[model samples]
Target: MDNPTAGIDRAAPVVARHELTIRAPATAVWGLLTDVPAWPSWQPDIVSARARTPLTPGATFHWRTAALDIASTVYAMEAPRLILWGGPAQGIVAVHQWTLTSSGPAATLVTTEESWDGAPVRADAANIRQALDDSLAQWLGHLKTAAEKPR
Candidate 1:
């Protein structure tokens, strides 16, 4: 799944935010988010992924897509609440969060927020912004479909 062809946006620092609501419980979403190995099934952008070590602070993981190669290290992991991490320098530093709230008797509101802080592939802020915006949108769409699926 190594995306040797994946374009890297190395312009100025860019920030992207993507959010989605899931009908599933926070716990369900948490399970999927924390389990790095399961990402390929739902996250279409990531063709394959695996953690080089367990998912703990400082543990590294490698993920691949048709257009990108992502290497990340877990910064924080608090089940049913938050999971944050970033990638190697020149790579996207991402904070992936899952917030679950009780809606009523048999339902939960699962909200996911993904943000990235990094340099753009070029100097044009507009172009970088466009890429970030598009990337986040695609990511959120993939996450929404995956998180909403039956476990």
Candidate 2:
């Protein structure tokens, strides 16, 4: 399969990827993924998220996290399957992508990958990579917990 991060600079210093199976239908998981405004409620790293326009290609959203405030544009969207978004933040260029697959009637396998490039990232590649790993892991855990909870 072609790498989703292929478009990102191969020289990127920090890259993180994580995946988990969620015991919830893809429809349920997709809803949570696309609802940008509700991110802060479950995503501990996100302080706030707002997207004035629908999450279509070229649409932009503002996100605030403990590390930086970033304005990202949605680059692609494939319904309950995939979404990709990225932009420059705090002097770093980043691209993030999520993929979903229906493992069964009530289970979805989710994967997320991110790449960071720029002088800032290169200056502290090890620490940045570790941080991204931790962040992505936490995000997947939170999503799994939320998705699997009895509703």
Candidate 3:
């Protein structure tokens, strides 16, 4: 498969990557990941989220988080596997990607990667990196909890 974040420089100073294993099927994880409006329920940092149009390539979504409000466009989407989206917010340009792999009949390996650039990100790389790391970790934990619960 093509690299979802191909254009973004991985060596950039303000980049954050996180991965976690979820004991659930990829379909379940993918459903939760793509449901934009439901994000705030599991993602503590997200204040609100609404898709401006259907979630497909070039479609946009507005997201409000504790740090900033961003208008993100879906750059890539591969059902039950990968989704990538990002945009500029508060002087920072960001690209976020989520990849899911089914490890077994009822297990999955989930990874979330994000890259940030622009003036604000470069000005405070350390804090931005830490914040992104923490946020990603929290997101993964929330996903694990949500996915692990019995339906």
Per-model tally of clashing residue pairs: 8, 0, 0
Which pairs of residues clash in candidate 1, taking residues 3 or more apart in a chain or in different chains?
6-67, 9-120, 9-121, 10-120, 10-121, 11-120, 11-121, 11-122
User: Which candidate ranks first by lDDT, i.e. highest?
Assistant: 2
| Residue 148 local lDDT, model 1 | 72
Error of 3 at 103 (Å): 0.6
TM-score of 3: 0.92
Per-candidate TM-scores read 0.71, 0.92, 0.92
Q: In lDDT terms, how accurate is model 2?
A: 0.86
Q: What are the RMSDs of all candidates, in order?
A: 7.0, 2.7, 2.6
**Model 1 TM-score, 2 decimals:** 0.71
Query: Candidate 3, which segments miss by more than 4 Å at Cα?
Result: 1-8
| Candidate 1, RMSD to the unseen true structure | 7.0
* Candidate 1 residue lDDT tens string, 76-102: 666666666655435445554445565
lDDT order, best first, reads 2, 3, 1
Clashing pairs in 3: none
lDDT of 2 at 44: 81
